[model samples]
Target: MDYKTYKTDDFLFDESFRQWTAGTSPEATAFWEQWLTQNPDRVHVVRQAQELVRALNDHYQDDATDARLTSELRRLVRNAAERREAEAADTPSIPLGQRISPWRWASVAAVIILLGFGLWRYGNVNRRVAAESYTHLTKTAQVSLQETVNTSDHVVNILLSDGSAVTLRPKSRLSYPAQFKATTRVVYLDGEAFFDVVKNPAKPFLIYANQTVTKVLGTTFLVRAFESEKNVIVTVRTGRVSVYTQQDFEKAQQSGLRRIQGVILTPNQQMIYNLGDHQLMKALVEKPAAIMPETVSREQVFEDAPVGKVFATIEQTYGVKLLYNDDDLSACLVNLTFTNESLLERLDVVCQTIGASYEVLDGQIVINSKGCK
Candidate 1:
């Protein structure tokens, strides 16, 4: 296959590309990585294809055969042609030349057929499983549990037995034990919710949503795991939360381990777990709030402050890491005041002042610049 000419959809339909994206074949992985490194300009298209492949794998069944799909496609075209012929016989014809040609009609029919097949391929097979998993868990639990389903259009508040609070979003469901009698407080969620958990170091709070499991001690976080969605997102507002796959969590449970090491997301960080591919990605949240708003100094006005000092102040206020060479930014100075500007906005102004640029990588900001004159 001429991969150089392949677009995102073309790559998605390729077997070798899918294998490379899933890391199933070592040779494919090496080949694609080297190809990408050599063709740097195609990085965006390749990455987009990789994400789509993962998503398609997670949502579609691989057991589908080309023969079956082809047969279905032919059947659809036949039915569509027959219906068009019947409609034409009942209607009065204006002129043969004015009517659509047979090839054009066939082209339109093919496009419609392809679109319908795409929808069928992206079926709700996994969605059904995710929706039922929460209910199944709650029913099979040994302890007495209470489930609160927010059927209303607005958010519904639920006070857990541990004094923690949950604001469940519409069409979301949360199941928790009637009492915190066990060593840990556990909850099963099928939709979305914002949690404000009380501090309890000895007994950690765990939330199971779709393929991801989140564990926290005492923090506020948001989990959006709608069954219809292809990704399970966990965004931290304050403190930290450990996010891991459900498979790993189950393995730890079977081994009788009290703790499991996973991706640690602090304040202003978010984790997205693709339900289809089981891929976990960590990045900075869309909008980062200050770690402690009250603690932020009102007089944040900086006049000719060292760029490193400005970065330090931003990091302190947001509890985020800013990576840069001290020697490189040592001579760079900034004169700016930040009152309620977002993290990215502040970075934009700083980078503009210093004739530099910034990029967010794995939830940290990396500043790139030549030494100041």
Candidate 2:
């Protein structure tokens, strides 16, 4: 399928997309990941379509009332037809055809016990049917739980029914559903895992660990909530993720689900939830990777580029915003050429050239310096 030009709805309707999003098909995931890397602009739209699919695939319900009504209608039609047939057979006067013989009376006596048992059996048949159907309904209502315990020395590749892939580190455990409900996809995490979640905007993906909960629509991220550690940490890789305490669920309910009432983390950002203090610390990752990689072949090189232009290019390539402490540093032009340097290296050159310094604040690069003429 030519998914390149497909909108959100188109992707939702495509079975291949479903399989891909569900993470059930490894081939589809590889194809999709490659396609996304090649066509970065489509990532946002694809994520939206993925969300729509999850939201719509809830466990279905069967309406017993409708079924009963259909059966009653059929019975009524059959009775009316039988009445017409009787009238056609005799019109005004139907003759009594036969008198009960002595043999028939004897036969009734012969089967009297059997007939009584049959009547009793018939009375209980409907109740049995109701009970069986109720059992099926109950089974559906109760979620099919599945658990993965990684005992291997290497990380375990666990594929969730909803298509999210979890790379569970050794000695970790994850509990999730065999089938997800329509509203939300939840999984319990203990220890460390990296999740490459398929996007389903309508149904958000949640990872609950100890007292912390990490939620996202669709993103690549990591969660570390080992029983040995006192803090639960969540780090974003590709998209946005939100982290909050379990106690704040009431806050979400009171405020409504319209807004995320938690600390939001963008790509290359991480949030650590301190179990003791009950506080969350948001900061940049130790080694922050670029949001978008610079293809070595199509690398961009600047020669004597203005500092503002340089900042804009960095923002475009990596999607990281840069804020100037003052207008003086913002206007100060720099002379430099950059090729294949890491984003930080490029930023360091730009800042050093203008005798300024930069720091990442809330996933943004903030330049700090006195005025440079």
Q: For model 1, what is the C-alpha lDDT against the true structure?
A: 0.81
- TM-score, cand. 2 vs. native: 0.58
Q: Write the per-residue lDDT of candidate 2 for residues 1-373, one digit (tens) a residue.
A: 6777775545644667777877789988898899999999888778866764454332111112334433433454345446556755776554556544433433332234234334544565445334323233234435766778899899999999888899999988888888888999988787899999999999999887766778899999999987567888898888898888765753576778766557988877889888666688888787767766744225576665567787887776665668885467556776666667777887888888888898888667788888577
Error of 2 at 337 (Å): 2.5
Where does candidate 1 stray beyond 4 Å? 1-132, 256-261, 295-299
Top model by TM-score, which number? 1
lDDT of all predictions, in order shown? 0.81, 0.71
In model 2, residue pairs whose N, Cα or C atoms come closer than 3 Å (at least 3 residues apart or on different chains), thus clashing, are 22-163, 23-163, 51-200, 51-201
Cα lDDT tens digits for candidate 1, 50-122: 7655654554444356456446655766777788889889989768779876545645665566566667765
What TM-score, to 2 decimals, does candidate 1 have? 0.65
Error of 2 at 272 (Å): 0.7
